[model samples]
Structures are given as C-alpha cells and as structure tokens.
Target: MISVVILGAGNVATHLFRGFSLAENVSVTQWYSRNLTTVEQYKNEVDITDDLSDLKVADVYIIAVSDDAVAKLSSKLEFENRMVVHTSGSVGIYDLDKKHNRGVFYPLQSFTKGAAMDFANVPICIETVDKKSYPLLKTLAKNLGSPVQKVNSDQRRVLHLAAVFVNNFTNQLYRIGHEITESEGAEFDMLKPLIVETAKKIEDLSPYRAQTGPAKRHDKKTIKKHLKQLDDNNHHKAVYELLTKSIQKTHGRKKL
Candidate 1:
C-alpha cells in the first residue's frame, strides 16, 4: 500500500482524500490545513492537524492548495527529498519547492464542496521530471480507478484553459438562461432536457457539426427579434450579438 500525506482542506483535497480512503491499496497517513476546522472531521481516520512540524513520513505528499499558495506552502514543509505532488491543472510541476522530488497529480474535473464524484470517471494528468516516478503515480491513480494521462506543462495549461471554457464559462451561460426564463415567469427546469441532450450530443460529434439555432441558420429576422427582446438588459444584448456574430463567422455566413 502507498502511504500519502495530503496537505490542503479545500474541495479538491477533500475529494481526493475521500477517494484514497475508499481505495484498498492506498493509506492516508496524515492530512493538514492552515485552519484546523477544515480538517477536524477526518481526525479519527487520519492524523489531521494544522501543524506542519507534525508531518509524518509518507511515500507521497500531495499539496492540494490554491495556485498562488502552492510554492510558499510546499517550501514551508520541513520534510525533504520525499516524493511531492500538487493537484493543479494549470500550475506546472516546477512550481513546487526544489528540496523534494516534485511532480503534478492534476485531476481534471470540477469539484464541489461535500459532493461525491466517481474517481473512475476522473482523468488524472500526471507529470514528473524523473521517469521512474511515473509508475508510482500511475499505480496510485489506477488504485483510485482514475484514467491516467502523461501531460506536459504546456499541454496541461492549455487543457486547463479549455476546461474553464467548457465547464465554468458554460455554467455561467446556464445561469443566464435561468435568469431569462425566470424573468418570463417560466420554470428553468424546462431547459434541463435541452441542456442534457446538448451535452450528450457532443459526446458523439464535434461541437462544430452539432451547432444549431437561429445564429447558425443566419436567420436575420429571428436574430433581430431575440436582440430586441434582450434590449432591456444591455449586458444580455451585448453577449447575444457577440455570440451570434461569432457563430455566423464560424459557419462561413456573412453577418446580417
């Protein structure tokens, strides 16, 4: 069994620790957070503490903190020359303190507080300077049932940017849709099926091929009507016009 010490108490850290707890081949030796309250619940299962001096010996140390804090926090680790990894999609492996064997264990997925996600579906992007360190990471990821990918820093950063566009930015659009429907006194749930099918459709086809609606059709009448309806909200009108023009450009249609 591989022994791991996780340092962080945010959504990603908590989710990963939970995944490790369920895996038979992994042992979570310790967990830490700057604030004790964040990790107090796990005290019975693992050594949960805020004190960095109390860190126990482990095969791997996973630093799952915010991007800016990663370097400073890892530098503060009194332990040295141990295998250390961070759980960030955008941050490169070299950002960690140089005293230890550094790498990345980036889980490419959105994490919500206290929400359970299937590890098997999570694609873990691993990067390491030493080739020998790969199999250990592969083993740990596989034990959690995660599909592993060997991603370099450049590719990982771009991948993270793409993820934000698809996940975070897309969710904001969903919220806008909800607000629009609510203003019309209609139930937002009415769009749920459309949302689900839109996602599922992309699974089998490229988004370019799956593109639809008045913008793609270049129907000036419908476009004008939609813009007129959104006139009360200048922000909504601006976004609508911008996306419509983008779609027209993408589909090789001249703007109306």
Candidate 2:
C-alpha cells in the first residue's frame, strides 16, 4: 500500500481524505491541521497531528489547503525530499518552490463537506517538476478512477477561468431566476424541468446551436418587454440587454 499524508481540514481535505481512505492501495497515514482537537475524531483510524514535527513520514504528502497557504505550509514541512502535491487549480506547481518533489494533482470540481463525489467522473489535472513523479501521480489518479490529463500551468489557469464562467456564473443566473419567481409568489421548482432539460440538451449540442428564447430569435417585442420588466433593477436590466445584444450579434442580426 502507498502510505499518504493529507494536510488541511477544509471541505477539499474532507472530501479527499474520504476518497483516499476508500482506495485499496492508499492509506491515509496522517492527517495534519493547526487544530488538533478538530481532527481528533480521525485519530483512531489515522494519526492526527498539530505540530509539523509530529507529522508522520509517508510515501506521498497531499496538500489540500487554500491556494494562498500552499507555499507557506509547504515551506514549513520537513518532507526530507519526499513527493508533495497540491490540489489547487489556479496556482502553479512552482508556487511550492524547491521544498520537495513538488507537483499539482488538481481535481477539476467543487467539493463540499459530507457531499459525495464521484472521482471517476471528475477530471484530474496533473503536473510535475520531476519526470519520475509524473507516473506516480498518474498511477494514483488512475486508482482514484479519474481520468488524468497532463496540463501546463497556463492551460490550467485558462480552464479554471472557463469553469468559473460555466459553473459560478450559471448558478448566479439561477439565483436571479429563483428570486424573481419568489417575489411573484410562484414556486421556483416550476423551473426545475426546464433547467434540467437545458443542461441535458447542451451535452449533445453546442450552446449556440441549442440557444432559444427571444434573445436568440431576435424578437424585438419580447426583448423590449423583458428589458422593461427588469427596469426595477439596473444590474438585471444591464445584464439582460448585454446578453440579448450578444445573442443578436452571434446570429449576425442587427441589435434593436
């Protein structure tokens, strides 16, 4: 079995720890956090430590901390030239410097505590400074049942930015839709089927090809009516107008 140690106790840490614990060839030998009391619950199954010196030696150290703390925490560790990897999407592998055999094992998905994650379906973006460490990462990723891809820092950053647009921005739009429905005493659940269908269609069709509604059709009357409805909120009105104009431009139609 490949002994592993995990640093940090946040949502990502919890999710990763759980996932690794279930893997047959990987054992979480140590769990480290600044707060020993908080992680004491896992002590029966794995060693839990607050002090860096108390950290147990392991074949691999996975840093599941925030992007900003990765460098500082890595510098504090006495890995003795062991392999180290971080689960950050936006940060580069060089951020860990020459502290150890540094690399990135960023899983491209949002993690929430106690929420189950299907690692097999998630894409694992891997990078390393040492060629020897790359295969170790790929093997570990495969064991987790995720598809591993080699991506440079530049490409990873671009993928992260695109994820924010597709996931975060879409969620924000849903929030707006929900709020609008609530204000009119309508059940937001009514949009559930439409939302699901919209997402399903995009799996087989390009977003542009699947586009619908007044914006895509350039229906001036409906567009004007929606704009007027959004007039109560300047932000919403601006967003609607901008998106409508974008859809019209995409279809080579003159904006009204």
Worst 10 residues of 2 by lDDT: 247-256
lDDT of each: 0.93, 0.87
Off by over 4 Å in 2: 253-256
Compared with the true structure, model 2 gives a TM-score of 0.93
**Tens-digit lDDT track for model 2 on 74-167?**
9998655889899898988988859699899899988878778989878999999998889888888887888999999998999999989888
Question: Where does candidate 1 clash, by residue pair?
Answer: none
The candidate scoring highest on lDDT is 1
Candidate 1 local lDDT, 22-126, one digit each (tens)? 999999999989999988888888888899999999999999999999999889999888899999988878889899899999999999976779998899999
Estimate TM-scores for all models.
0.98, 0.93
